[model samples]
Target: MIRRSRWVACAGPFLFPWGEAGSRRVYGLVASLAAAGYDVVVAGGGPEPLTTTALPGIDGPGSVSHIGLSEKPPPDAGPLASSIQTLLRWGQRTVRWLDAQPTRPSHVLVHGGQAQYMFHLQRWCRRNRVPLIVDVVDWFNGRHVRGGYLGPLHASMKLALHHYYPRCDGIIAISSYLENHYRRTDKPILRVPPTLDVKNLTVDARQTVDDSSPLRLVYAGNPHGNRKDLLGTVIEAVGHIQREGASVELRVYGPTLDDVRHLFDGRPLPDGVRCLGRLPQAQVAGALQEADFSVLVRRPERAADAGFSTKFCESLASGTPVIANLTSDMGRYLRPNLEGLVCRDHSLAEVTEAFRTAARLSGAQRSLMRQAARSQALESFDYRAYAEPLGSFFRNWD
Candidate 1:
């Protein structure tokens, strides 16, 4: 009998049952690691805490377990206070949980970029002679700076990044831009971009494209203030296409109908445009499958450029071609006219033209594009393959 290597993952206070992009990424990595014969324990959940649920669809291979924290942060607490409380609580619970284990984890994977818990975890790892790895999933500093809500908290987190991250044993970056930003001369760094479980997410048989049906385009994600530019661009482009008398419809999920109306400056949605509101992950997958194309347009800001959208992979996994702007590492992954269309600019005219190009494709051509999308997903973005790099890194670490 072989003793499986044990690992612990700590993602402070943000765990979910499913549907969230970030949580899904973490779950995918952990599940893949378990599938590869590691004994894995994921410590997560706060605020709205999670109950002990079976790791989604994971069974009969390697061992995987979840330890959900029941302590919830106060709703009235400020951002810094809430984060600090959550971190402190998680650290305490983690230490107790570790003490109960027969042996300490070989490595500790910290998911978030900046956390007070990381400092505590680092000290713990140091005392135990265990490797501590930080996965920088997004540019948290850029987001805080752009968001303008937590000034002092952002300053402290920036300091923490410079101070604690360098001391970590390894770093996992989600994009090339992030890898460059967090590069440390003494630490081992791996660029593992966001990936999806293509095998599970993809449709078994490609659906036949009906030429007579309207050219359906779908966009799903929060339409928050920072994301206004992309959502606005897509809305205007859809309006432009409608004015041209094109048989097209842009269905948007994630944002409420009232929010979508507000985004269009209180005016009515353009012809053939509908706000479908938020949908479950399964429903979003269904929407992607039913659509001819999916849209993701982001401005070339530092925050946007440093992070790759998980939706890009999810869209392709659903066998729907993407119409995305050249932001982040999207251009590096998506080949124009192969997996999807990449817009050179984020202007309405450019996105509108891209839509027109996709709309113009014949049924056979569209089917080919869908096949290309799924092929690209399986080739590059499969979660199992995505986990191999990190697995090797973990195993090779002395």
Candidate 2:
């Protein structure tokens, strides 16, 4: 029998069963790798896990193991200091673990732009000759920095990232826009789409939504000021839709709902607008089942939005048509007329017209769109398809 000798270390923010963008992608990839028989270790966060409970039928000798922040740092440190210390500790632990292991990994996959982790992992891999693959799903310098104190931190991280990219064996970027954005690195950059967990899709047709209610338009995502402010235009557009007697309600779900809710500032909604705070990922599909469509209007303010939004795939998975304003790199992957509508500008008229067009589609037509959405998702966005290339890369890394 082949001894399970290959050990792969995958690290990211802690993600449970239900996860956000980074968490979802990292967890899905790690699970797949574990099932394929490579001993895998996942190290990340400990604070606000969406699902702290373990997932049934997923345990194994080499299944998901969360590395907690508390294991390294004093539990009471401020968030920023705590994160830095966590990185230092995580780096130290990972190096020690790698050094003491009986068999070294063929490859190491590092996610995100944690500078300390990247530098330490690369240095150790170089010394030990383990190929390191870095996935740049989002960029730090050009995109992630938002307004406020976080901006400077992000700027510093970007500098570190620029300095670290050349040291990796390979890089996996999620979008072509990002691939081209970092062309100066002169390293092999693989453009991969964000993976969709279609298994979570509970509804296949848009008709599952209650038609009696005003056209249910929903936006499920972070409500932070940088990306969340786009909801303002959504409200303005929904107001226009309501003026046309198209009963419309906006449902905002995700961690940043408070940011979005505060944007309202007691300004009366036209009528049906409601804000449902962060809902579990398991609950999103059922909610999407009850809604007519999903909305994401990213203001061109940060690079985070310039990349891709997880809600984009989630919207497609729910078989709900998406109405988006900013045309980021995602525009390259979306199918026209079959999946949903993409607006050139965030004009009230544009949103109103898009809704009218959606209202005109027959049930069968909507079902066709839903199927197309799923097909596109499975072919382009699912993680399963990516395993071969990624696995082959590691398998051949001698």
Candidate 3:
């Protein structure tokens, strides 16, 4: 399977290889697409000036040419000047690949960035006869910045602009909600939830859960940006069970202790809850692999449906079942008594009951679930699983 096609991606708002959740998704996409044989190039917004780097490849057999695009403006640059500068960067870097490279890009996939930049990119792709695919991952309506009076209005406008799909040729949705939101459109849609490297997926690190040791639960992600509102509820539920003498421990993995403390309004965390603070990805993976379950129980809301939980897939990758509720298209993938357990909802009563359910599971039963989780990761979340499908999907655009 050889492909001469080149696919360039715009890594909006995220720095390649090092940014948060969105960056990892872009990395996975690049890896999968490259394995599919396309020459994948990623242009990411960074605080620094536009330049190429010697970063190692996540793109399996191939290497990704990473060009850092400065998202930050010069201190004295006006908005108009900044926008013009950005347009020039795109035109010079992505659009003019034909001048310096042997082949023009067949597709331009946007993870997202500034609205002005996206609008221009869309128009150019249309004029140049290139397919423009928007990766619709999140739709949180909160104001993205701390701007003064116009913050709300600006945020709303940005949010709305991202959802305006009339100009887009295709969509790579992170959830069913996002995919279906644009289902009426004539554009092609591909639902790709949080995916990771699965080549070395091994559940052997997780052994039988012992009744003597605590039933460990891990949560890894932004504490507030994603409205990890249910984290407090999870803490309380675990506290309640601990009071009842259940052996359990909840681990918080993303935010620093100070940040977590501030988010909880200076309130104390419940017993059996440990704020491990922002940890290295390796440590987070180690914790997840050792845990009985990873947690992602958000309340049912539009924000919840707008995107999938990357941590949920991470849990599966670590062979850890999740104590989660259905949001996005998560319910479809979770098997209640198998790879993962889903809560009916994210309320206190339901969350408490979910904890009890885990408490009741025997060591062997939990081991079976862990094995199921590893299988699920290998079957569904592996980058390789999407390589052929994405190849076929992009090939059809021609």
- In model 1, residue pairs whose N, Cα or C atoms come closer than 3 Å (at least 3 residues apart or on different chains), thus clashing, are none
Error of 3 at 271 (Å): 2.8
TM-scores for every candidate against the unseen true structure:
0.89, 0.83, 0.85
Q: Give per-residue lDDT, candidate 2, residue 272.
A: 75
What global local distance difference test value does model 2 have? 0.63
lDDT of 3 at 129: 84
Q: 393, model 2: CA deviation in Å? A: 2.6
The segments of candidate 3 whose C-alpha lies over 4 angstroms from its true place after superposition are 1-5, 10-13, 47-62, 73-102, 143-164, 201-206, 262-265
**Which window of ten consecutive residues has the lowest lDDT sum in model 1?**
47-56
Q: Tens digits of per-residue lDDT for model 1 on 244-349? A: 8788988888888888887788887888888887898878878898788899887788777777788888888889889988778887768988888988888888
How accurate locally, in lDDT, is each candidate?
Answer: 0.73, 0.63, 0.71
lDDT of 2 at 325: 67
Task: Report the lDDT of model 1 for residue 72.
Answer: 39
Model 2 misplaced regions, further than 4 Å: 1-3, 13-18, 32-37, 47-66, 69-75, 78-90, 141-152, 204-213, 226-229, 255-258, 300-306
